[model samples]
Target: MDLELRHLRMICAIAEAGSVSKAASALGLAQPALTTQLQRIERAVGGALFLRDSRGTRATPLGDLVLARARLVLPAVDGLQDEVTALVGADRIGQYRIGATNGPVAAGLVQRLSATRPASPVTVHATWSADEICARVLAERLDYALVGACDPSLPAGADGLVWQPVCVDPVWVLVGERHPLAGRAEAALAEFAGEQWASAPGDGCFTACFATACARAGFTPRPPLEMDVGGCIDLVAAGNAVVLCQGTVRAMPGVVPVALTGSPLRWRHLLGWRPGGPAAAAAGELHGLAVQAYLDVVAQRPRYADWLGTNPGFGAQPVTAAAVSRR
Candidate 1:
């Protein structure tokens, strides 16, 4: 009758899949068995967790509330299990789990970490938002994450963690190669007002940072088309829409990344981790590794690299002791 981790996971799976059958399939349980289990869980929790209809299953108000708390609890429990397992088996001690926003930095970090510690197997989760990565770190699911957030918006709540500033990145506009303004070195943000934009939705501060920059340019951007990362880039390549992204963004075959006039959109690269954890203890070493990764990625792109060189302020700076003290 007591609520257990398995019970919480089952409800979460059902809520997310929006169907008991699909959730059962995902969990490798028989439909009838899952149904029986769900009934028992509802009895323990004192209410029906899901309302089923032809449309699909939906979480009830109480179910929704429980599901929110489950997400926060489940990851921490998983992390504790990993920690205990590591203590019992020294060989498993070096496994590093990381979450990061999708970009060259995350790719480069994985490559460098592997080379730096061949014995440590690296597991990565590439996401659209640094805030999500930091949340995982707080939950003890990630050793650390490379995140970026600008003024007026802090990444991952800016609480219960260490924040190490790695570098400053400017946001750039991307357009199709054949577009009229593609060859321009720099253009005012207002120049692209007529163009449609495609960007990944719900990326916390990223969407707001872009909007604030646009607002400063004397206009508000049109509502963006919600899509995945590939879709957003594809829209740019097709000349149908433009997108805004970090300076670390790679140049696509048919998509050109150009700077904005006066560098309106700027964000700082930060290393997010639990205070006094392994990451904070080894902060200097990780910071150096990240700097090399950024340089390596930048060197591969002729236009972006050239711009980066001329703009001396854009590259990684050494992580100072004072910066670590602030956390």
Candidate 2:
């Protein structure tokens, strides 16, 4: 049997999903059919590609070799399709369907696009997690996503996507302005073990990451009050509870963002989209818009801004006062 583009894409999906069943569901195929197809592909390739385990499917040595080539081939095919589609028709090229986790950049991107391309329609969606946003983008529900990743590593299933690193946003501790630690330069994560945290309700991966980070600091954050980031700020401001927030967050009344002594918390901001798509084609413009927005935020908070500047190359892109403006 001649292995085709569909076969290659399926292999990549399986590798990323880490399970045949999950990959099959994502591809809208039955698990048994996917299993049979996987077997055939293995036979054609002359070796087993993945090893099944209780943990999940992991790529074998042969599988890794195959995937490396598949990544290159898949994007080349996508580029060809994008070019051809653009040449024949431009109807779907202008509209931007974008999503983002809670951040200032998403609003900035939408506003900037509206100001620049007044005729082009921009749709923005909000999800609690980047993984879900990435899934929607892969499904073509979103043209691109501004995602946050605390781990700094790309999640699985991003084989053919273009990811541009924007910055590393430090996660700050939010407390009432009247709180004891509010006036301090920094505090330790363990010091807040007894305090209640206000968090947004969601099954997003951030919940797990947050829990793990707190666990490492010697305690799990107590049961948090369910609320959006804005609501979290309100609660924190009223001296009701504390919450974690991004460093670039604006100055909310009655609340103050204090850094942790070790500064152990951070999340990488990334722009993710399919290669050769409209979003990928406009990656530089998107990055510049995000950088400008971030710089504006940094300027307002001198403390974190100084910390950000000193930690150059630590994931936050270097931007000068001049670079913040268009050339």
Candidate 3:
């Protein structure tokens, strides 16, 4: 029998489970049938891939080699399937579907797009995971993804997507009005060394970036309490912990977002879509609207607007001439 993708998957499953019986259960196959299939796979490969001991199954050198190749091949094949599915089920000509992580831009962008194209049906899906949003875009469930990432890192699942920058905002600290640092125009990271930190849950590099910043400031950060946005705000307002937030975050009742002195951490908002897909035809218009939406949000936060004026490079990035022409 020729080695097929399913055979490779089964091999990987057995290697991962460390026992034929366990792998069979996980794969929803009877042990005897799985053993018969395994024998056929072994004959096709001309080697004993795994060794069975009384304890469990372990991969031989040949099995390790096969596993490594299977790992690479599987994801590539999966990506190809997603891409083909997207092409086959492209969005309707006048419809717009956007996926977004927690941020200010998505809502505003949707509003602007609906206004611009009154006949077009615009929709937005919210999530806490940029990777999930991007995968949806790749799978054609979303025409675009508006998400934020730590300044220098791109979202995962960006392989075949085109990402355009909307803006770069400084990361700020949220503290209660009663907190001593609340009155300060800007505070240093070292000042928060002993304070407990809380933040909205997200699948991004911000957590690692925050940790590195704290280490550079000569202290280790406590593992931050991860919760929804409202929970994070509650923690900050109660003075139980401080939260990291974007500069454009609006004022809460008792919480204020203060800039970090040296701007140790920064976030970049991005709008991504599958290249050459239906969204590509309107990418320029969508990107322009996204940038304007971000600017509008910044305007609502006077403190952040003034900070942007003083700190020139942290606002809307100039769209390059080449980028404009491409769009």
Evaluated with lDDT, which candidate comes out highest?
3
- What's the best-to-worst order under lDDT? 3, 1, 2
Top candidate on TM-score is 3
Clashing pairs in 3: none
Question: Tens digits of per-residue lDDT for model 2 on 1-327?
Answer: 456666688899999999999998786555654776688689889999999988999999999999999999999988886676556445667888888887657787777878888897889888764555776677566788787766465533344567776787778888999998999878888889889899864323455667778999999788777767788888898999999888777786899988876667777677778766677677677777777766666777787778777666543564333221100
Q: Model 2: clashing residue pairs? A: none
User: In candidate 1, what are the lDDT values of residues 37-124, reduced to their tens digit?
Assistant: 6886898899988999989999899998999999999999888877875665444246777777655566787799899989878898
TM-score of each: 0.71, 0.66, 0.74
Residue 105, candidate 1: Cα error in Å is 1.2
RMSD of candidates 1 onward, in order:
10.4, 11.5, 11.4
Q: After aligning candidate 2 to the native by TM-score, how far in Å is the CA of 110 from where it should be?
A: 2.3
lDDT of all predictions: 0.75, 0.74, 0.82
Candidate 3, superposed: residue stretches over 4 Å from native: 1-91, 321-327
Off by over 4 Å in 1: 1-92, 151-153, 324-327
lDDT of 3 by residue, 119-193 (tens): 999888887767667767876778898889888667644657777888998988999989999999999989999
**Could you arrange the candidates by TM-score from highest to lowest?**
3, 1, 2
